[model samples]
Target: MTSLNVTTTTLYMARTISLCFLVALMEGLDLQASGIAAQGMAAAFQLDKLHMGWVFSAGIFGLLPGAFLGGLLADRIGRKRVLMASVALFGLFSLVTAMAWDFNSLMIARCLTGVGLGAALPNLIALTSEVAGLRLRGTAVSLMYCGVPLGAALAASIGIAELAGGGWQVVFYVGGVVPLLIVPLLGLYLPESAQFRNARESAPTGVVRGLFREGAALPTLMIWVSYFFTLMVVYILINWLPSLLVGQGFSGRQASWVMLALQFGAAFGTLSLGWVMDRLPAWALSALIYVGILGSLIALGLASRWESMLAAGFVAGFFATGGQCVLYVLAPHFYRPTIRATGVGSAVAIGRLGAMSGPLVAGKMLALGTGTTGVMMASAPGIVIAALAMFYLSVRRNGAQID
Candidate 1:
């Protein structure tokens, strides 16, 4: 009887984890839908590179408040409730994005959708950890989180299929509609965070303040810098790689196929990096990953041939996306259980600032007539900064709570 009970509990935990993956997948699909559609959106709106950059930044900017407020709300309410709400928010706005008739409306809808997507993440991480026992917690969370890139890969596949002739609207329609449908399933089957419910809520405030407590300043700052730089690289790739490819003379369809390679490489990186981090010192391995990433970016600058383009993109995705994943995997190691969600959430929220800057900066560079080579060259420093920070993190790991 006890054995059967244990088996049933394990099965239930697995189901919870699977649901988290779906939610993460929803975020990936919705977030990248705009990027995939950027060229079409620009054409539809009759906008230039600079204007389109704002559109990109708008959604990412929305992510900041979305993550901050979302994490707080999730703590006050329940992770399941907040998760469902965020999913609904993004889904509804995504539909609104599809129907947008002008640039302003499109920007508004995407930003609002960003809110929902941003809010969903911390809860997903928190819930994933809440259900997982300590021994398997890191592995389980990383596995579920890989759904984000997989969703991005699937979004690229939509373009590859030329569904609706690769129309931008089709991307949002599918992105919005699918999550709406998933909401019912989550509401019905997903459970709230049991730990959150049982614990005495920490005054429902002072969330960020906790990170600045004694002995927690430098590591907190270092991790935040790492998250910022890494995400800057990650999201610049996410939002502009497709459009940049188009600028480099590839067709939209072809660009998306390459972007698909990038996202899939990211998925591979996330999984592989997690495995590697378990076996080696994370900071040292991360430095190596950034080295590979820089090389890939430089090579990507020179990728004029189709084969070279694909190969460079894959390597860039492998290292950049993979390195970002390494950051995510290493983030939670800096906090105790009580503030695990808080520390990770704050870092991710700060990273969204970097994500916001990426597209806009790329737009400015392109507006100044920077070619693919120059653009790729310009972005390499983001990873270099990230590598330096992570290396420092390894040497001066004093800012974390020493529980």
Candidate 2:
């Protein structure tokens, strides 16, 4: 390529990643909003743990179809269009969540908000991977994903600040409005995927057959396994950690601090681990992330002191969220551009099942008097399974590269 071409490609990649990062930021904030607002939301709606669990699960359930349909649509229409629509949908519902008058209304709003949030993710991953190409895919995706944690941290800060006179609705209000503001910017500046456009003339593959056919079956299954378990742990922590901390005798303010630390750790982990993923051996990276997750979970369960819990939260966020980023990075390698979003979306949709299950399970365990330790310990076996599956994928990926 000429210097001019190289410069243009660089510019395009920068633009795409930057805009995607902004969207990821809003997505992250909204994902964590319910958790941050849980206490107030529960009190406002007169909800118990089981009811809260349903509330959490309701939003996650929307993610399942959103991811699949979003990716499918991106392949047929375009990534940029699907992403913008997803953002607008989530933003609108987030506002509705703030204005919710009853439990049913709240659940309905969150579920719709979740659909938008879920749809945005696959396109974000697909767009980042395509623009960065094979070489910088990990770094670029990680960099974009870092927005999630930072945005979560911002939400935590809002919680800590007791914004809008500490009204829980304030967080939702912010989450809703900012994404709407971003929609026009995306429409004006975000470029469609060059790879997707280039591949448009080729015969499209059947969605199911595309994912399962050829040599993709095993990798697809493995990715699903890893995503399911990894996200289960991540979502459990994201949605439950604050409440768990409060249950353990800490003040809500203290829990917010720990949550903030966790988000900061997540941002750092996402960026650092993503860079390492490109340079480190896949098996080694897999080992590092899972081991960190296990250790963090143990520490979180055992820690009693406020400082110790904060530290544990940081470590948990680092490995759990970072490991999730690894899965997102690896997914694009298994499919061509024609179905890349479909493949990633399918895996993400499967992961959402895990995500939905985790909070409800924890809610049940807590209601049954099992406590935080039991919840943390129960997650261990799944992490081990996820580790082994990821190890297999890492080994397989070493010998395979997609254009």
Candidate 3:
């Protein structure tokens, strides 16, 4: 009987982990497909580069409100239900986006999609962490995050391949359809976070405030800083790398390939970071990752030739993506279970502001001819600030009790 019980428990955990990964995959596809379709979208809408950026930013605006509401809903209703509903909503909007007749329609659809995407992430992160044991939590979270790079790469490949035959609309169609297919699977497989349920039952008054008011404030702030910096770096890479390479004299096809290399490197980096996180100090690991990123960025900026640029792109992806993954992994740990969703949601939403700003600022840099060296140097400060914040948070973690 004991053997059977252990087997059942193990199987259940495996199922939980798998479902979490599936959620990440679906969300990644939903979130990143548009960026891959950006050039085609600009051409279709007769938008200049700056105007094209608005379509992307509009989506993030929707995400802000959606994330807040979703966090509340997760605590009030249930994480599993919210997760499934958000995925469905995102998928539906994606389909609408594919059919958009003009830029305004596309912006509206993207905003709606953003709302769903924003809501989905916190619940998913909270639920995944709840099921995972402390010993393996980082691994479980990172496994789910591996979907991010995969989804991004999938979008890029589909976009490039169908540009001639199907155009940008097909990219949105695939993004919409794929998540819709995953919705039923998620509903069937995903379980509510047990911790969320328990917290809802026993949480004290003003639970959300406790994230900052209680001793948790220090770690929470650290998470915010790390999340913001990591996201900024990531968006800069994802939104600008292909164009950056092309401007450096690489062919369009070669630049596209470089982008893919970054995504692939990110996937592996997430897995490797997850493996090392438990064994090493969190801040130390994060700092090391940033150091690697800083070096890669410098190399990328100074590389006189294509071979070096490609190599630097791969390394940049490894560090940038992995660094962000760690922030997500650490978020839940920074707060008590009662406010876990809120904590994660706030960090993600705030971090997204930085994400939204990255490409815009980079565009400004291009306009000013800031050059790769200046742009790359600018990113280094963000990393250093985030690392210092993480170090402080680690100190606080030592004194606090995490529920």
Maximum-lDDT candidate: 2
Go through the candidates in order and give each one's C-alpha lDDT. 0.79, 0.93, 0.77
The residue-level lDDT of candidate 3 at 401 comes to: 37
lDDT per residue as tens, model 1, 137-210: 66777788889988988888876765357577887888899899989999899987667766536533665676
How does residue 130 of candidate 3 score in lDDT? 74
**How would you encode candidate 2's per-residue C-alpha lDDT over 63-143 as one tens digit per residue?**
989998999999989999999999999999999999999999999999999999999999999999999998899999999
Best by TM-score: 2
Tens digits of lDDT, candidate 3, 1-403: 9999889767766787787677677677666666667767878889865676677677777777777678767877888888888888888999999899998898899889989988988887777777775666788788888888877777667756764577778767887887789888877776677777777878767767877785677777778787788788787777666667767788656666776777787888888887887678756785788898899889878887777777887898888888778778777777777778888888888888877777777777877888767777789889888878766755555455355
Q: How does candidate 1 fare on TM-score?
A: 0.93
What lDDT is obtained when candidate 1 is compared to the true structure? 0.79
Candidate 1 residues lying further than 4 Å off, grouped into runs, are 1-5, 163-166, 201-205, 392-403
Better of 1 and 3 by lDDT: 1
Off by over 4 Å in 2: none
Residue pairs clashing, model 3? none
Model 1 — which ten-residue stretch has the worst lDDT? 394-403
